[model samples]
Target: MDTTRSLVYIAFCAAVIAVLAQVMIPLPLVPITGQTLAIGLVVTLLGKKYGTQAVCLYIMLGAIGLPVFTAFSGGLGVLVGPTGGYIIGFIPTAMIIGLYFEKFGYTYVHAVIANIIGMFVTLLFGALWLKLFANLTWSAAFISGVLPFMIAGIVKACIAATVGLTLKRRLQQAKLLQIIQ
Candidate 1:
């Protein structure tokens, strides 16, 4: 597509992430948020280039104190906070998911697999950051930061994969979004 349209898609996806970040199940350490689901959708729909751009834009917005992160939190402090790793991790997660689709086919199975992997990638980043920043042991981090969200993350991945692929297909058919990997 044209540059203008691509940028619009990226900006729109970033907004989607910001909006979805508010849907959360509060936890002591890191709340379960729809940010991941939005990430999955953005990458699945936009592929590597635009998908990664969208994630970066979202992170930059939050880092600049835009209240775009979970719980309406933002600013550099939030990025360096215990939960910041997950926010930062969204970048690689989007790239990896997009790469997965680029290499493999954009089928439902592939989308689900890529999204699950992306979830794990984000969890790994969050757990590691939680351990170091919070001064918690590995076991403590796993229990508090990682384990609680596994099931929920899986469910979100599946939902994102399903919805993302469906929307991508429909958009392409309608000539709304350009054909993506």
Candidate 2:
């Protein structure tokens, strides 16, 4: 891809993440959002380079108060808040997913495995942050922050893997991402 195309793809993925993040089921401690699904899609479609770029751009935008986070929240405060770790965790999550696909090939099984691991990565970060930021015990954090989201995360991972791979194949067929791989 050319520099312009790369930039456009990165920006577009970041925007998609922001938009998907708005689709959430509010919980007491942490809300379940489509951001993870978007993350999976971004990495599956763009791979490590553009995927990581997009995640970083999205985080930076949110850190700068662009209303790109859950419920349209953003800024440094949001970054340092209890749910902030989950947002920050997107970086490694994308990297791992992209790396997995890069090494293992973009098979359905691999995508599902990568996404499930990514989900756990995000959950660990969120749970730890929730513990410290919320002044809760580790178990409390696990219960309130991580446990509630596991089943949903798994479902989203499957959805992301299935949809992401399908979209990637379609995009490649369309030549939209022909030069990417």
Candidate 3:
């Protein structure tokens, strides 16, 4: 892919993920959405450098009051909100996923493990932030912020992993991976 085309593609994926954030199924804690799955897919398809850049761009857009976050709310408040940890967690989550993809060839099993790990890392960061900034007890935080999302996260991870593996195979077969590289 040409530089311009690649950048455009990255921006498009970022926007799609941002839009997916709004399509939420409200849960006891944070609402569940397809954003994480999208993130995993983007990283797997785009590789580490561009994948991380795409997620960073998404974060920057959301932080700047672009309404790219869930419910079309953004700005500094969103970063400090109850779900802020998860929002902010996307940064390292993307980085970790990208790194994993680059370091290990994409296998369905490995992709599943990688996506699960990435989601767990996001949850860990989000939970910690909730405890520190929201003044929630560990038990309360876990109950309200992490536990409720566990099953959903697992499902999302599995779906993302499967999709990512499939896409990787297609890209390799089509020689699109070489163009992207």
Candidate 4:
């Protein structure tokens, strides 16, 4: 892609992440958010490099105090606070899922698998950060950080994969796939 189109894709995906972060559930420790689904969608659509850049841009916006984080909150404080790891976790999540599509192929099955694995990595980082920042024990961290999100993660991954593949196929058919990976 050209420089303009690449930048546009990054900016657009970053905006999508911001928009998705608004759908928060306001839980006690970590709010249930649409971020994972958004990451899955962006990675499946943009591939590794562009997708990672988009996520990084999203983080940079949040780091600079943009209200792009969950619960419409942002800033360095939010990024380093109790739930910040999940926010930071998007980087690797995008990389993992996007890498799968680029390395293997952009199939529905691959998307689903990649998304699931990415979700797990996010959970791992989230739980670890929760343990450290919240001063919770490992079990407690697992309970609060991972347990509640398990089912939702699977559902979100499936939704992202299904939608991603459908949209990808449509784009390919329309010859607009050249703009993407």
Candidate 5:
């Protein structure tokens, strides 16, 4: 893959992730989403620079009122909604995961660790956002916003790590990893 091809691939992956965001598995609190898996996979496969660009583009498209978020809802309202913090956190999440890939290269364990860290970042931002917007106390906001998602998030992170490592191996075998960077 050339630079242009790599960029196009990244964009396509980002679009796919955005579209996946709309296909939500409804949960009591935050839904079980495939978006974070996509984010982790993209960063692991594409490395820091292109991976970050992919997530940024995804967020930008959603923010601009494209129905690219979970439940096919978008716009500034989504940004200020209870789920907004999670959305906002995607940027840093991708960056952190990408940093791991950049520094240590792609590995299953590293991918999992990076995603675990990313989940914490998401929770931090999400809890704060919930507290501010909903006027709930820390415990209430955490219970409402973060606690329910804990187990699911860990499962998703594991899945993301597995998928990322698989993609990394495939890309490496195909000798496309160099082009991705």
Candidate 6:
């Protein structure tokens, strides 16, 4: 892709992630949000390097007090807060999911698998951070953050995979992606 196109993709995905972050089912410890779905979509559409770049941009924007995070919240304080780990986790999650898509090509099943793995990555960071920041036991953290979200995460991930893979295929067919090998 050209420089302008690459930048557009990064900015567009970052905006999508920010927008999706707003849609969530609030839980006690964590909200079930479309952020992960957006993450999955970003990875499936953009692949490894660009996808990761886009997510990182999103994180940095939120971190720098862009009000781009959940509930219209953002700032360095947010990054160090209870939900910060989940925010930080977006990086590795995007990279892994993007890598899978880059290697395997865009397919619905693979997108689902990649997003599932990505959710685990988010859980790891989010759980650990929740435990430490909230001063809760590991099990408490898991119960609060991970346990309640597994089924929801899986269902949402499947939804993202369906949407993202379909869009990716359409974009590819339209020659929007270079698909250089």
Model 1, position 166, has a per-residue lDDT of: 95
Q: Model 3, 149: alpha-carbon shift in Å? A: 0.9
15-83 per-residue lDDT for model 5 (tens digits): 877876865778665676777767776777677778888988888888899888888877989999888
Candidate 4 residues 65-178, lDDT tens each? 999988778899997898888988889889988878888888778888999998998999899999999899999999999999999999999999998788767877887667
TM-score of 2: 0.97
Ranking by TM-score: 1, 2, 4, 6, 3, 5
The local distance difference test score of each candidate is: 0.92, 0.92, 0.82, 0.88, 0.80, 0.86
For residues 1-181, could you state the per-residue lDDT of candidate 3 as single tens digits?
6788788868977987798788789876578877787888777777777777888898899889999988888898988988889878888998898777767867788788888988998889888988998899998888887888888888988988887777767877987666552
How many angstroms is residue 155 displaced in model 5 relative to the true structure, after the best TM-score fit? 1.0
Name the candidate, 2 or 4, with the larger TM-score value: 2
TM-scores for all candidates: the values are 0.98, 0.97, 0.91, 0.95, 0.90, 0.95
Residue-level lDDT tens digits of model 1 in 1-181: 7888998999999999999999999887788999999999899989998999999999999988999998898999998998998998999999999899999979999999999999999999998989889899999989998899899999999999999999999999998976556
Clash count for each candidate, listed in order shown: 0, 0, 1, 0, 0, 0
| Top-lDDT structure, candidate number | 1
Error of 6 at 144 (Å): 0.3
- The pairs that clash in candidate 6 are none
* Candidate 5 residue runs with Cα over 4 Å from true position: none
Clash count (model 2, backbone only): 0
Per-residue error for 52 in candidate 3, Å, reads 1.1
Ordering by lDDT: 1, 2, 4, 6, 3, 5
Quote the positional error of residue 40 for candidate 6 in Å.
0.7
